[model samples]
Target: MRRLSFAIATLLAATAMAPLAIARGPDGPAAPSAPVDKIVDEGTNRSEVMRVAQYLTDVIGARLTNSPGMRQAEDWTQAKFREWGLTNVHKEGFEFGRGWSAKNAGVKMIAPRPLTLIAAPLAWTPGTNGPITGQVVLAPMADEAALDQYKGKLKGKIVLLTEPTDITDATDPDFRRYGDADLDKADTFQLQNGGASANRRPSSASRMAFTAKRDAFLKAEGAIAYATMSSRNGKLVHGQNSQFQVGATPPLPGFEIAAEDYRRLTRLAKMGAAPSLELNSEVSYDDSDTKAYNILADIPGTDAKAGYVMAGAHMDSWAMGDGAADNAAGVSMVMEAARIIKASGIKTKRAIRFALWSGEEQGLLGSMAYVENHVASRPVDPALTGTNRYMNWSKAFPIKPGADHSKLAAYFNLDNGSGKIRGIYTQGNTAVVPIFREWLAPFNSMGATKVATGRTGSTDHVFFDAVGIPAFQFIQDPLDYGSNVHHTDVDTFDHLKPDDMRQGAIILATFLVNAANAPEPLPRLPLASEPKASDGFYAAPGAH
Candidate 1:
């Protein structure tokens, strides 16, 4: 999953609760169908979910989109889908940027008491040809305005990117499951008084522009390399870099150092010790294909006119860890669901499609491209290029539905972690609450209970929900994902729980079958329209 702010994490929408008690199906309170029992048996007794995760994470390694690893993952997933008797298995290509991976990276202090530091190269950034030795400088460059202050002062220096701050103790446990109180809190509806775009920070466009300009300045000033402090207190490093487009690649080698090591370097530099450091970043770029592909396969339905239901997960991850808890878990569950359905010989009226999206870490690029190509689209401003287009797309007007707009019954996403299914965020689609409750009843004993009216963002489901499709992300146990493993060096296969994976697969398979054969398509939230200005002090008379 992409990183999210507190606002996006707790984002909520209004709900019309009139339909909460009544199921939409013509038959009252639909129970788990006979197919669900078969799905559970297959997913529980004959599950291969752990093996799938092992192959994807342990074998494939980190799948940076369009890189060699990602290409291998796309091909392997399609092969697996075909091997399981899924029909129409293929890869759908989308315009993405250059792919990059770190071959090797190291940083160590050479002067003022030698010490080795934990670090990794920032993704999509250039690599030093070999080891580069230079004196460290605490430049603390934040934005373009600070560039003028360091003019002609950074020559042959390893610049520390941000000011070091004292680390604080964590307030909450690193690993946790949803307790009854937590689920009850989630079930309560939190009313949103204003528009979603209320209090905002600088746009991503401005950030990207500043990053490109800053990199150019650094290179022109003869800086040898740059290092940034890790966000967490532990020796955790997340090699996150977003300048991945063809023309916008970063100009200088970048590394993320462990927080404690970075602070020590900062202290040394502050005391005028003039610490010297040796840096080496061995990396490569793959420009062989500018396009990334999303792996897709389908189970054909009996009726041609009936629409399709889908399950999806991103198959891309950061360069650091094996990408296990972040998304390989989700991918494994999605694959296991498909295998279970096929193996159980369950038939449905509507087709079921399983999708493995790529370029998700960068910004829901693959899924958004798929939505634009086959689901729905709105006119985007030509000036909004790269990530900006996706960041600001929900504000676009006059959404135009594609031929498959209505044909898509629903899309369910799984990307939180290797956590078990706790519940689901309904995104305030009131009409589906009762139906979902019915669908979730079978898993009550497995701890999948709550059906919240709140919403969450920063995943592949955002675009589908924005375009008025019935899309949702399940609420999963955190289980050290947010605290210790998410995008960190420890996000490996060891953190995955086999029982959680099996539970998720069973629930996913059951939900897909229910939606596929439902009497009617699942309800959709209204299509987006331009929202009223949140802070209306300078508003136009009729701007809405």
Candidate 2:
């Protein structure tokens, strides 16, 4: 299993970053007080976070964006919010090209050896032509010349292009939680520059050149399909696609087999047995129904004139798994926090809003759309952006009237995993250090004691943080999130711990209440040093 990178990158002004992201402060810098004991005790005693998590992951299954499951999950969320007394429950839509979902799929070894196989097709790829039979080929397609060598040779062939999974020894405990030392290590990380090569796409440049070569070769050779091995063990499938652009060419049918089964085919072909296989798949893009969704619910405040505090988690997930730890856990956590506070009868000066976002897996699409619609905007900042950057950065629009940018006091987000919350990421606004330290004080006994000054990325909070509002993501135990759960078929209800879920609910609810009743809004970063517009959700092919 690959190790998780705990280090955060240096803050950039384009995304509303404040220098290094953290420091230590001994006392409150005027943080308002809350009835933490009452909220914490009530939240800890009777919580349904896990129950809701189970319902979403086990019952509703994967909520892939714009899919039937996602649509149903949206309706379910609104129903639950209304059931929980959250008023003004509704859905907001955004325009995107299309949605993709996986249906029935199958693969098997039929000749030279007859056996059923554990495998799945990559999402958004073309499906097989009804279990077409083909001879297997171990075509590396190593370079442009190699791809040419396979010309006409791959006709009616099943091309194997990937290696078996890395079944390494457990150097570290996969099931264990984080220790104090781990938190200390993450807390003290230096904010490093996002170098020219810092965040380039995996296997970029050469990857694109070779991919274009291979795609052309496959199309010319009339290959049956492309098959690779799953990256994780036990037939857990993992895949992602970026060809959602309008008029993108139809991708060739692509499939992934279990690591062990993959090596079996490789061994047979290498030994000259020339095994043959069968594949059948069904998939389609929802181009006609391509509007994305973001679920919203408001707990109306008594002081109608006061600002509001917001919290949310993305509800979308990879279609292969139940999306238990990667996000359903987060979705339920936010829902339960709202329920806990409402049930605890914790009233505040500011309103609290709960959001369940979609299109997060497809490059923060839903959250960025939300920011464009509500909390964030691109006001004229002469110090940051020049004339050219303004026209090109389509996402950098100024906050519009009645968008409620001013009323938004703070936004808290959770999307790490099922681990217990250990602390908060200051996101480089050190003034909040003292305030968060105060908010987290109530949960010290529950093992959520630290408040780190690191910048965590690739989530919804960045959408809010991009506009200079106070936003944060909590630090949690890693567990097997990186190795086994994330984007894997094993991301199911079993990975979530009820105790951990309850603890997270208690801590975040208290934080929400404290923020809602705070004497002043959380301090904001004086816009970033020089805003240059975002590079994008993911680094471009030429970024390296």
lDDT of 2 by residue, 352-408 (tens): 999999888876777776776776555534332211222222333444433677889
Residue 239 miss distance in model 2 (angstroms):
3.6
TM-score of 2: 0.83
Model 2 misplaced stretches (Cα beyond 4 Å)? 1-32, 141-146, 163-167, 192-213, 245-251, 377-403, 529-544
Taking the tens digit of each residue's C-alpha lDDT, what string does model 1 give over 110-169?
999788999889999998999999998998878777889999999999999889999997
CA-only RMSD, every prediction: 6.8, 9.2
Q: After TM-score superposition, what is the CA distance of residue 533 in candidate 1 from its true location, in Å?
A: 3.8
How do the predictions measure up, each by TM-score?
0.92, 0.83
lDDT (C-alpha, whole model) for all candidates: 0.85, 0.75
* Weakest 10 consecutive residues of candidate 1 by summed lDDT: 8-17
